[model samples]
Target: MARNKYDVDEVLEDKFDVNQLKRLLAYLIPYRKRFVSVGFMMLSASAFTMLIPQFFQKVMDVCIPNKDMKGIAFYSFLTLLAAFYSAFSLRYKIKYTNQIGQQIIHDMRYDIFEHLQELPFSYYDDRPHGKIQVRVVNYVNSISDLLSNGILNTITDLCNLVFIIVFMLILNVRLTLVCLCGLPILAIVIVVIKKKQRTAWQVQSNKQSNLNAYIAESINGIRVTQSFVREDVNSGIFNNLSGSYRKSWMRAVMFNFTMGPSIDIISIITTAAIYVLGVSWMINGETGITVGVLVAFTAYIGRFWAPINTLAGFYNSLLTAISYLERIFETIDEPVVVKDREDAVEMPPIHGDVAFDHVTFSYEPGVPILKDVSFHANQGQSFAVVGPTGAGKTTLVNLLSRFYNVDSGRILIDGIDIAGVTIRSLRKQMGVMMQDSFIFSGTIMDNIRYGNFSATDEEVIRAAKTVCAHDFIMEMENGYQTQVNERGSRLSAGQRQLISFARALLADPKILILDEATSSIDTETEIILQKGLNELLKGRTSFIIAHRLSTIKNSSCIMYVDKGTILEKGTHDELMAQKGEYYKLYMSQYASLM
Candidate 1:
């Protein structure tokens, strides 16, 4: 397996780009109605909240000073109405924002899932399973928070700030102007901290993803680690990744933790200045501002700073959320390399005549895996490929199914170029059994039915019988209803192979490809599978990548592959008589079996 190469610094730097954040926010456009409702509720709350100080001014200036009990009662009732409105507005804002947030999360998760489905096989090969999983889960969740709470709260806070400032100025311009002197400084500080924290948090998030990928790889390959006795080495690597994550987190936290308190300290100093100046002016009879008005101004000053401080605290979360959005957007933006061509047509059902017309392929440019590998299998013919490991035998099967497109030349199914055919239509006519069989976590019946979802119970049983797997399946405790544990851990390798054979048999495809299907089985089971396979191969164009020499001895033709090309091609008897590459390979393998 190739080692993963991921750089935390590169991923982090990419996260801070403004374009990435803007694109992520664009997902919220479809939920504009909910956002509008939430905005209205926020505005209403701010309006009512701003009225409270004016109500206090009213009670002091007109009601209490006049000694008019009726006037005081009326003013108090109006204050109560404002409080009710504020409470009602808050309720609506909470309900709408939360609904909008959850809906955006749902849509984003679905979009990521759909994109993953459309991505090519090469994408998976180049990326780690754990990394992809972390991107899907962590990145999407972060984006959800960004859309729901971060953006919504930022908008509300800004609205509240505007309303508070306007009302404060209306009450006493001198006091408001004095308090506003600190606003520019606070804004500058927030901008600086936001920039620093964005970079730090992006680094932290990348480290987290890298760490998650490492952990996933370690856990999935624990068996290999244990067998190799390299647990301590693996632990050291994990510790190093986790340490990097921790250091990055602390760096981000250092900047973020200072923002809220720093803003509050500035607000406090501004408030103290206002109190001292107002008191001196009143004592000197230098202004018309009353003590009550000064006190209300102080309250409004606090309200002004409150939103700023809250927004400052939200900076860290915003950066983290944006980092997640960047990761998700990266995945969504990955080009689909194997998509159907615009004019691609649905392939007709196969009569099993497959032709490889100078088919050359390479996953990477300038490094070909199959070099001009041309061959043909007529209807009802069994062709065998004999090659050493890494001789591109399995690559041949992969090309036939269009798992990876060829770099040069073309493959034809019954004279129709595969490149012009819809992938679904092309794959539907084939049945493939890999060297390592995979049984999903489900009942035996379900596993077999996976080959043909619409297969009846009778059809499933018949398929199993055809593959000689029915007897063993019936002997199990729950028979066909038996549950296979994860990856069929509960079953022996041979049993899993038998079940896999049944699955392919159920599909009854015209074209069949078996890549070392019976190699893992015991001798007795292999013999049994051989009998079933002979019957299955009667009327299909089968390509077998055989490990056991006996299996390919009766094939219609045997192609000896070497260094990505066929060195020799002939029937088993003809090749044996030639005493060439095929003869040497067969004799060596036969000697091992003996």
Candidate 2:
């Protein structure tokens, strides 16, 4: 069976990956002062906590026994003072850590999103949106606690355990040794359980990614599902995915819960053994063990186990976070495959001459989409490409726009190799209107202004008028201010096409490309738009791809393409005189219309 998109690598290392942690810390360097302040606060809080038992021991042994009420009050006041200091330290620590963590998240998210924009179209073509979305939004959120509180909590817990150990030894060496006996057993239990915990968490993460990917894909294609009456089928698939997620999460939770009980049992047995040994020693008059000393030892023992349990929980969280951290780094580390050359310069204003000198290209190796294709268009000429489906019509426009580089040969503009010019400068001079007129979620006015950010409202209105969209705009409830849903689902296909046409016109580029531009427009609207389009194309180099026989009948030049090869190139009358592929196609379509 083929592996699914959500199958996360099962054998990824579960240890505390030092490199990942180091890279994550690089995001913290900007807030180093705040982070250091948080560390100092944590240390102060731990110190206060460690001192509490000492004060309690003094009260029991010296103050209460002797009925020294003044001493009792003084020591009690000290304890309260330590607690207040601890609280003060904690308040600043939390405030600083939260500020630092939130800033890091903001910077990291911004970097990821900006890098995504720099990546080429092929990157998006090869991956599912949901998988990328999860990495950007969900996986990034998983590390918030690990960054803000996890480090400080771990350090404080370790310090508390050490202080408890030292105090236990001072109060009574024999009892301390009994309590320490559980250390080796506890280590064994943690080592065994943590591996299982990490594995379970990794599986859980994969399951969650799968669920997210499914939901996003289904929602986008809901119309197809409803059309086919496959709602039941989709629900079944979703149930299976959700079920797997539940199972994986439960397995991880069980492993997490198992650690606490296992440690508790060992703790109880160690406490019982200490009591037995200490009581016997006191009775024999061999070991000088006082009641107050035993009380203090008991208190230290509880304190020691508290941190140990807390550390165990932290270890589990660290395990889960490590899995998520690796996922985040994978995306951040992806190489920018398409980048400008170091010495690339801005392209000068175009004179509208474009030439392809034996250009050959392919989306994948060993399968060419354009085979040694060569063409040229002079300034102010309307060049039309007419071909069957998959004849590389759209690919020609993509190459002109440098959406993808040619596999071999050169594409030149005004005798300059396009590859030597800066991409932004080259693309800024061309206006493209693709067959799929994708409209963003915004008002109709905003959508039209997207092509030229600096275009004024007057320019937008004029552009809409040129495309004959002004009539429909006034008929709408809000005129130009009407809201468009995502993908323009609320508008008809022809309206979306007209909006896109207006966008392209607003740019006022020297080169204009219309790839099946009038495909969605009704016959009447196409006639109106074409009259304005002809006037607009008078002084601009234009590339038109259309299947309708009459659409390109009067072009300056026409190329009939098939199987990535141009079979005929001529004017309409010249091509009809030759009686070749173009003539046959034109005559067949004309007969159908008649």
Candidate 3:
């Protein structure tokens, strides 16, 4: 297997980008009303909370001092009303915010998936499946809590903090000023610690993505590992990945743990100073500072620090989310390398005259794959391409399907340049069957119908029978309804190939491409499959890439490709008569059989 060339873990820079955020907020436009409703409820809840301290101050300074029972009862009832308002407003705020958050996630996930579909094959060629899976599943999910509760809670904290300061000043400017003496130090600590936490979290996110990629690759290739008896070696690799994740997480935790203590120490020293100053004012008779006023001041200080602590914690959460947000936005912003032109038109139902007009192409710069290649397959003709491995045979067929665009020249079907037509229309008329057929998790009947969703039960059965898969399928316990499991692991390679053939035949596509479709099957199965393939190729232009020269000997035209160019083109006998590259390949296969 080729080593994965992609670097899955990239260090993040610019923990926050306002432009990326503005783009993300576009998904929430549809839910603006819900956001508005949540904002209002959040502010109402904060206001009601602010009223609680005032009630406490009044009861301490007035009701208790007067020994007034009615006053105490009235204040208690008012406090109860404030509590009720706070609770209900918070309930609605949480409900609305969560609704909006879920909606945004849904939209964002859908858009990411759609964008993945539109991305070119080359994009996936170098990337790992696990990294993409993490972005779509885990990274996208990471933002849910931040969007739903974090934003509104942060707003509420700020409101409470501001209202507390205003109330503290009205109560006693001197005490309030004394209580906030440590404010500058607290602010600086929070800013410094939060920056460190954000960088730590970025490292953690990278570690997480790397771990996920490893697990996905390991699971997908478990058979190879087991065959090679490398379980211990693989396990050691997994341990290393998991250990990195743990180390990063703990490093982040260290920063998180230190924050609470640092804030608390500052808060404690500030509270002690307030007491010392207020008591001295009373003892010296320098001010009318009663016990009630002193108690209220202490209570107000607690109120002020509570939001400060809460905001600090909220900032921690926001920093962590920013890392994931950067990754999510990066994926959504990826450009679709293959897209239709502005004036491209839908392809009419094709007559399947495929022509490669002196096409040249390369997967990467300075390394050409197909060099000035050209060919034509008239409607209803069978063209066979035989080549050594990596000779660009597959690339040729891929160009015809428009899976990748050419560097120069054009591919035309019935005199229409494929690039000039819409991708959906171009692909709809083509049916492709590969050697390693990808069988999705579904019943055999459903898999066949995947070729043509509108195909009926009878049509599906007919297609299977034509490919000689019906007999073996019926031998199974569930007949057509037998489950294939993931990648058709339950079926033999030959059976999978037959099912793929049946699927292609069912589509009745105008052009059919079979890339070594018979390579996996035994000779007996290939003979049966060949008969069905002959019938299927009767009315459609077909291209076959085969190593078994005998299977394509009767094709209308044969091309021998090598090193990014066509070395020979003629009927099989015509090439054999020339006794060149085609003759040598055919004779080599014939000699092997003997």
Candidate 4:
């Protein structure tokens, strides 16, 4: 429920984070050479284009007037050659820049995914999965164009603008001066639009994230919605989110669209003024401005404003991308709280000697899930943790596996501090089967083999049989090869649990954890499952968290936990004789059955 965020754009941080953009530059460092080369190519192409006006001036002012056909033909041929090379050079520039963008996206996505894998369970506990999913997929895709052509184009155009201005000044400074006057009006418009455009886009990005969160949540809970006949209500909520996103997008684009037209209109007005003023000056025989020079000057004016238009477009893209980059970099910047230390060492083969020395932990600060919980399980011991829901039964086993670091204490395996050992090595020797059995979309055999990739087919089948999964599996047409999607929707709850149990067994871990692993399985199946688990659990320190006292009666020690502390601990008969919390819990279940 905490992960379900239904609100749309509830809290919008309108300010742009420049640090995120600076951090993103690190991804470009590796391909800086390619980007530089692309810029160089674009600049070279612009240089050839700048020559076209000179070609025009020569024909209008000298070649045509002298009636020299050879000179006219030569300039015409040169212009054609320059145009062809300009077009050819631009092709490679576009090709290589986009390729670099794709590579950066791949690297960034991989880093986010890798970090997500290492993040603590608490990271996922606080945020909707859709919010996280958008950053890795949609948000990364949104910034690719900004990285691809935006930077190179912005830089190349400015350089080209400068090159064009120098030529314009050489032809006629009076007209060039007229063109410079437009820059002030364009600057004012940009200053007016920049803040509004950025703020709008940030809001748009928030609405988009909210919409995706609701969509993912809806899809995941569609069955429940249909069962409760709440489809209409759900659709209404979705429509609201979709409408909010659309409105924000329209608002953002309105500001972004203003940039290009404003530049274009200012450019044309500036051009007209120059032409009119130049003609009058020439008509009055003042300033010595010629017809050929006037024609070339107007052409240079077009070249100059073209880059300003490009810059306007680039600024728009930069603002949009910065909105997305904030989310993307935010994910990359997330800390991995439970991770291996720099000096951590790989754990040797586990002999199942696990000890919790006054371990205290909490998913949230100031509220403990397990307070000062200390226990020792020698090799081959089975410890059953029984408690009311939310009383830290599952948390005990979660700590044993170091899924979350202890807030105030340490956990040890065979006298080695778990925090000092590499997490991959520590977990490799442990098998955990939780209440939720997440089956990825794949063949059943592949799903089981996920526990241990090197496991052979024979080993996989044997593990499946140990949990009574092989029979139902064989009943299917494809048996072991049957395709089961994520969460194993095609399989019944018990069948999915059996496969997950088999996956744990396939890992052949020294320490086994079963937290309500049999809750969905029927009593008959559980009896058979227990029989196999009893033998497989031999010489392995196993922690079983079950409400059904019948399953844990044989545990070496049964701890009755409540309110983050153990209320009772002993064998079933010992606790029943003591008539403690464990006895009361067992009797209540017995009374219900009777």
Per-prediction count of colliding residue pairs?
0, 0, 0, 0
Where in model 1 is the C-alpha error above 4 Å?
1-17, 286-288, 592-594
Error of 3 at 31 (Å): 2.1
- Checking candidate 1 for backbone clashes, the offending pairs are none
Task: Kindly list the per-residue Cα lDDT of model 2 for residues 475-494, writing each as its tens digit.
Answer: 99999999989999989999
The candidate, 3 or 4, that scores higher on TM-score is 4
Tens-digit lDDT string for candidate 1 (409-457) = 9898899999999998988889999987899999999999897999999
RMSD of each: 2.5, 2.8, 2.3, 1.8
TM-score of each: 0.93, 0.92, 0.95, 0.97
Q: After superposition, how far is residue 298 of candidate 3 from its true place, in Å?
A: 2.3
Q: Global CA lDDT of candidate 3, please?
A: 0.85
Tell me the whole-model lDDT of each prediction, alpha carbons only: 0.83, 0.85, 0.85, 0.88
Report how far residue 420 has shifted in candidate 1, in Å. Answer: 1.1
Q: Whose TM-score is greatest here?
A: 4
> Model 2 RMSD to the real structure?
2.8
**What is the per-residue lDDT of model 4 for residues 1-594, given as tens digits with 9 covering 90 to 100?**
133465935343333466677778888999999888888888888898898888889899898899989998999999898888888878998789889989988998899899898888878887888888988999889988888888888899999989998998888887888999999999999898888998899889889999999999999998999999999998999899999999999999999889888888998899999989999999999765888888988898888998889888888998998888777766766778888899999999999888889988888779888889888888999999998999999888888788888898889899999999999998999999999988999999999999899999999999999888999999998999999877889999999899999999999999999999888999999899889988878889999999888888899998889999988888889999999888788889998777
